[model samples]
Target: MRRIGLQLASVLVLLALWAFVAAMRWVDPLYLPGPGAVWDAFVRANSCYPITEGAARKICGESNYYLWEHLVVSLQRIGVGVGLGALAGVVVGYLMGSSRLLMLLVNPYLNFLRALPPLGYIGLLVVWVGIGESSKYWLLFLAAFPPVVIATIQGVASVREDQLLAASSLGAGLRERVMTVILPSSLPYVVQGIRLATGFAWTTVVAAELNNGIPGIGGLAFQSGVQLQTALTIACILVIGLVAVALDQVIVWIGRALVPWQGKEV
Candidate 1:
């Protein structure tokens, strides 16, 4: 909590400095709008009005327009991509960790793919899949899958060999040994991967949206900045950060639930 408070205080101080610089014309207000301008834009944006065409367009006055739809669109992409990637990572990681033959055959290819920069594929993906939700999801899945797979592999390999040997000596079959020992021991690493994957998902979602002309938070940010609405652009950036943090917290909560020992340690 202290860390979070300190980080937020630092952000507030930077914002204050920025506002002062712009207000005093040390920085061009057009280039670095004051905090007041940003807040006014944010309020208008949240009110579902958005100050379109440099005039107020409140829901009451203009019937109905809202950020909710855009928010929902972005959330849907995040949900589907993260879900698919995490599932695949866990399964493949388990296989590679437990099966020596599989690991030898797969690790090189996996490493090569992981080494590639994620954003480098945006143009190719757009060309192959077209500018649509499908491409967006594919990009996000690529972003998330590698970390989970690596964590699972490490977790499984890190388990004590003696435990498995003992289980085998007691006439425990492969499935029983895995259930009682491997899965339980490797859970921490797997959870860690999920946490990392959440961050990856956010980056992929924004990049995909921006490059592909998708109508999501990234698109909104791009549109606002292009139209010279610096406040709205900054608000969109804030919204992205908030969403990433929320997703991260949810993952942490799940980790604590699954491994109650963590709570005890805390």
Candidate 2:
């Protein structure tokens, strides 16, 4: 509760400072809209359909800004890509961690993929997959894949070999050994991986949307920036931050629910 209060106070302080600066005219409204102006714009933008037919009629109907329905498309793409990428990464990472031969064969390739930026593959992904959800998925996958993979790999590798050997000596099969020994040992790492990958997911989701000209928050932000709607742009940024924080909290809650043993001191 104290931590929450401190965080709320910090946010309020920042907002108050921003209001002061904007009121003092320390920054140009064209570049940095005043806090009051941003609040007004947000009210205007959210009060009505900011991406409605009327909005299009007001702001050039055929532009990228013309998309009012693409936000849902972007959300779906991110959901699919991030979900699959994280799952695959955890599975493959565990397989590699368990088998030395598999690690040797797959680790180099995984490292190679990790080294490359998502943008480096955008053109190829677009050419191969076209401009649909597949391309966006590929981009988002690239964003989330590495963190999960590395986390799982490190988690499994760090487990005590003695525990596995003890389970084996006790007549435990490979499945039993994994469930009783490997999984419990590596759950903390898996949680950490999920946390890291979520941040990647958020970033990659927005970047992919903007690059593909998909109709989403990122596209909205890009359009507002292009049109010099600084207030709306700031509002979009704030929205993104809030959404990311919400997602992080959700992930943390899941981790706690799944691994309550973590709460007990050893």
Candidate 3:
């Protein structure tokens, strides 16, 4: 309760500061619109008034899509991208962790990929995969992959040798030992990686949707910025920030549910 109260108070303070800045003209509205304007922009994006009183009252927001549609499109892409990236990363990570030669072969490339900014490869992806959903998926996939790979590697390395030996002494085969012990022990670390990878994927969203994004939050932000609709852009950013925080919390909950044994004194 105290933590929640403190957090709410901090947000209120920030909002009050923002309102004061906007009121005092500390910054031009062109660059940093007032919170009210931004909120109105958000409401416009989310709401539609009835065009006709008849049965066929067509609903329409200011933009081509409502906020939910934009959110859904972006989330769908991230969902698929993260799922694929995590699967591949776990496999490659396991192989590399188990074999010195594989680690020597793959680590440099992984690091190189990890170090790159999304913009650096956006052009290459566009050329190779075209300006389509495939390109976006690939971009997001690349963004999600390396963090998870690194996490899994660390997790694998952290596995206790004694546990493995105990399982071995119990006549357990390598597969059984891995399935029962190693995977469980490493799961918490992998969840942490997924959390990290999710943040990366969210950050890459604007880049991924650069070429062809219609109903996507990041794309909306980019398009609105280009149009000089700063309020709408800021509204889109608020949506992104809020949704990212929510998604991160959801992942945290999932990790707790899946790995309840984690962090407990055993």
Candidate 4:
């Protein structure tokens, strides 16, 4: 409760400061619009609709979409990418973690990728795949892939020698040992990885949507920036930040439910 109170107080103080700056004209409205302006921009974007007469353009934000449309598309793109990435990461991570030869073969490349930002490879992906939806999906997939793999690897590695020995002494085969011991023991790490991957995929959405991304919030932000609609851009950014927090919280809650043993200091 105390922590929540502090957080709320901090947000209020920031808002007050922002209002003060806007009221005092400390910055140009074009650069830093007032909170009220930003709120109005958000409302316009959210309620915007296209007239079905001529060209059918939206009244605010993106030329083609209202805020909800942008949000839905963004969510879909992130969901597909993260889902594929998480699936592939778990499989590859488990295989590599279980085999010394495979780990040696792949660890160097994984290390290289870990050192690079997910967006850094977007240019190459675009160049190879062209500026299409595939490139965006691949970019976001790469963004979400590595963290989970590394986490799974760490989890597998953290398995105690005694657990393995006990399983072996009980005449358990490799498959049984993995299913009963390694997999369960490593679940917490895999969940953490998924959470981390979600964050990474979401952050990379703007970059992914940079090419032909009309129906996404990232694209909305880009369009607003291009049109010098600073208030709308700020509004889009706020939406992105809030949604990301909400997503992370969701994953955290799911992790708590799925891996109840996690974080218990026993």
Predicted model with the maximum TM-score? 3
- In the predicted model 1, the residue pairs found to clash are none
Candidate 4, residues 59-125, lDDT tens digits: the string is: 6545657797899899999999999999999999998999999999999998898778866888899
Per-prediction TM-score to the true structure, in the order listed: 0.87, 0.86, 0.94, 0.93
Candidate 3 TM-score, C-alpha based: 0.94
* Total backbone collisions for each predicted model: 0, 0, 0, 0
Q: lDDT of candidate 1?
A: 0.80
For residues 1-266, what per-residue lDDT tens digits would candidate 2 score against the true structure?
Answer: 99999999998999899888888889887887777887776666644344565564443222433333434555677677778888999999898888899999998998998888777788888889987767888888888888899999998987787888889999999899889888988888888898888777787665676565546777677877888889877877777777778889988999988888774532
Model 4 clash pairs are none
Which residue segments of model 2 deviate by more than 4 Å? 49-74, 263-266
lDDT of 3 by residue, 66-109 (tens): 97898899999999999899999989888888899999998999
- Residue 81, model 4: Cα distance from true site in angstroms: 0.8
Cα error of candidate 2 at position 133, Å: 1.5
Q: Candidate 3: misplaced stretches above 4 Å?
A: 49-59
Colliding pairs, model 3: none
lDDT of 1 by residue, 1-266 (tens): 99999999999999888877887888776777778887787676657543565676535211132344556678888788877999999999999998999999999988987887778888898999898888888888888889999999999997888999999999999899989888888888999998998788787666878764445877777777888878778877888888888889998989988977632321
Error (Å) of candidate 4 at residue 65 is 1.3
Candidate 3 least-lDDT 10 residues: 54-63
State residue 78's C-alpha deviation in candidate 1, in Å: 1.2
